[model samples]
Target chain A: MNRVFTWQQVAPDQWRNKISELIDSGFFYFDFLTGVDRENIDGQADCEVVAHLAKPDLSDSRIIFTQVKSELASIADLAPASSWYERECAEMYGITFTGGDTSPLLRHEGLGRPPLRKSAVLAARVLTPWPGGAEPEIREDGRKVGNVSRRRQRPPGVPENWLSP
Target chain B: MKHSFIALIEDKCTSCMLCVRECPAWCINLDSHTVEVTEEGARRPKKVNVLDSFDIDYSLCMYCGVCIDVCPFDALAWDEHRALTSTNREDMILSIADLRPSGSS
Candidate 1:
C-alpha cells in the first residue's frame, strides 16, 4: 500500500503540544512510539523519541520526533495509546517521560542500566566463557602443546577493562 | 517434514566467527588458535587458525537461522533429527561435539 511519510522535529518541551496539534489536524491514529539511543552519534542528544501518527483512512502519516537528554514531556495524555510506549521507552532507554506513568514495563524495578542504551554491556558475553576462546593444550595422543601466544580478542559488547587483569 | 535444530559441519568450518558475531540472540560462542604449519618445500612456516571450540546455547537461541545464512563455508545446516533436551539450564548449552550430526564421527 502506498504511504506518505512526513516527519517533523520538535523541541523536548513542545513534544506534547505537537502531538495534540497533529491529532487536531486529523492525524488521530497512533501507530507506535519508540526511543532511539544516540549516545554513539556525534553532536546529538543522548536519546530521540519518535512517534508515528496516521489518518484513519491510511491516506497520510506524520512522524514526530524530539531529542532529549534523559527526560521529555509526556504525550500519553493526548494520545492515550502512547502510555505503554512511553513506559517501554523509559525502561529500555532510561528516558523519563514527565507527567506519564514511569513504572517498570517489562523488567523488574532497579535492574541495572537500560539495555537498549549503547553503553550497556552484554553481561552474557562476559559471564559465560565464549566458545571462541577455546585453546587446546593437550593433543589427542596425550602430548602437551604448551601455551600459544596470540592477541586476545574480546567478544562484541564486552568492555576492554572487564577482561583486563 | 519437521525441522529439529541447527547442526555444525566441523570439517568445513573455518572458525571465522561470522555466526557468533551475527547472532542477534548472542547464543553462539567460539574460540580458535593460530598454529604455525611448515609445508613441505616451503621456506617459511605459514600461520593457520585451528578451530578450538564452538558452542551454541539453545536456551538463548531464537532459531532465527542467522548463523546458517551467514556461514561462508556452508558449515552450518538445519537438521531434521531431534535436539537434546534437559531439565537443567546449564545442559542447554550445546558444545561442538553435541552440535555435530549423529551420522558423522
Candidate 2:
C-alpha cells in the first residue's frame, strides 16, 4: 500500500517560486493543483492556492504543497507564473498568484460574473452575451453538458431549507 | 449505499482532459469538449459519440473518485446517495442508460 502524507500549506505568494524550484531540482510529478475560496467560509481566499508535487517513482511518498497567501482588492493586470490553475482562481475568486503562465484559462469574454463565489447578487448578475445565454461549454457524450449553478443559493445566515427551488 | 451527484462547471473547466486520459476502465469519453459519465442505465446524452464506448464494471470500481477529482473542469461530480449496487454480475455492469440529468424526471 502507498503511504499517504500531507505537506504543510504555505502562504500563497511564495507558492510559485517554491514549486518552480522543486520542479527544477527533481520532483517532476505535479500531482495536485487546486485552490480554496475562504472568502465566506474562512473570511478570505487570496494567497490560498494549493499545489502538490512528488517524485515520479513511488519510492518517495512525501508530498509537498506550496501556497501563496497574498490578497489583492482588484487587478489592473496579471503576474506571470500564475498559469491556468492560478489564473482561474484569480479570475473566479478574486485572488492573484504571482509568477509565470499568467493567463486566464477558463474565463472568457462577455460573461459578467464568476459563478462559484459565495455571492447571490453577483451570481444573478452573471451574464453571457452570446445567443444561447450564459453557460460555459462542456460536452459529455458528444453533447453539450450544459449546467447552471446556484440560482437560488441561500446566504450564510439563511436556513438551508428556507430557499425553495 | 452511498449515492452522490457531481457536475463539472464548463466555464471553470479547462478542458485538460485529465479525467479522460486517466479513467482505468475507459468509462469516460472526451468528445464534446467536456467529460460524461454513464453508468447503471442512466445516460444524459442521447447519442453518445466521444464517451460512447463506455461500460464500467461496477464490480471493479473501487469508488475512489479519482476520475471525478482529476477532471480539470471540475465537471465530474458525485451523488453520495446513489452508491454502487452490490447486485449480480449483469447488474454490476453500468452502461450509458443508467444516468439521467438532474431535472429530467
Candidate 3:
C-alpha cells in the first residue's frame, strides 16, 4: 500500500534539497505547486507554500508545505515543471521567488495588491453592500434599501471575527 | 419586424441595476435616488431609492435577452406587438415614462 504522511513545514532553504531527495527515491512526477494564505487562521503562519509530488505509477505521493515569512528560495530550476506555478504564487501572494521568474502570471500589469493575500481588499465586495441570500427591501417608489437585521454577512472564504466589523 | 421584442414594466422595477449591468451592448441606462418617505400608516420614514429614469437604446440593442434573464423582479417582458420603429435614430431610445402601460403610472 502507498503511504501518505502529514503535511510537513520545512524551512525555505531546505526546500530544494528535500524535494530532490524525494525525487531520487521513486517520486518522479511533480504534480502541483501553490501557496496558501493563513494570516488569521489559528496556529498557522501567515503564508504557506506547498508542492505535491507523485510517482509515475501514481501509487504514492508526497505533499509538502513550508511556512514563508516574506520570501523563499525558488526550486524552479530543480523542478522545471513548477516554473509557471511558482510564477503564479509570486503574483498572487506577493512572495518573491529568488532566482526565478518575477513576471506576473495572472495580473498582467501587476497593478494592485496580490489578490490572494488576506490584506488585499476586494473592491467588488466593498461595493456590493449586502451578502448573498439577504434581500434588500423594495419600496413603492422602486428604491431598495438595506435590511436592518443588524447581522453582517461574511465574505466568501473569510473566517469569522478575523476582521473588525 | 412584427415579432415580440423587449418591454419594460416600470412600476414593478426595483432599480436593482441587474439589467443595466447585464446588457452586453451597454444600451441600458438608469437613474435613481434613495428617499425617506412616510407610508400611509407608518410611524417613521423609510428609506428607498426612488427610480428616476431607466432608458434602453434599441438602436444599439442586439436583441439578446441577457437583461430579461438577469432581472430578479419580472419587470421586463416580451411585447408581441408593441415594438416601436421610426425613421429618426433618436426615436429608438425608450425611457421609463414612455414604457408605462396605457393610462397608468
TM-score of each: 0.75, 0.37, 0.49
Docking class of 2: incorrect
lDDT of 3: 0.74
CA lDDT scores, all candidates in order: 0.83, 0.47, 0.74
Candidate 2 reaches a DockQ of 0.12
Question: Candidate 3 regions off by >4 Å?
Answer: A1-6, A40-45, A131-165, B1-105
Candidates in descending lDDT order: 1, 3, 2
Q: Using lDDT, give the best candidate's number.
A: 1
DockQ per candidate:
0.33, 0.12, 0.05
The alpha-carbon deviation from the true structure for residue B41 of candidate 3, after best TM-score superposition, in angstroms, is: 27
Cα error, residue A29 of model 1, in Å, equals: 1.9
**Candidate 2 lDDT, tens digit per residue, A1-165?**
666776666444454456656666666666655555445424344334555666677545334443334452211122222255556666665555443345666767546545445542332222311111222345645566664332433333233543343
Q: Which of the predicted structures, 1 or 3, would earn the higher lDDT when compared with the native?
A: 1
Top-down TM-score ranking: 1, 3, 2
| RMSD of each candidate relative to the true structure | 3.9, 17.7, 10.4
- Tens-place lDDT per residue, model 1, B1-105, is 345788899899877777887787878888765667899999998766678788888998888899999999999988876766899989999988989875777
Q: Give the TM-score of candidate 3.
A: 0.49
Residue A63 lDDT, candidate 2, scale 0-100: 48
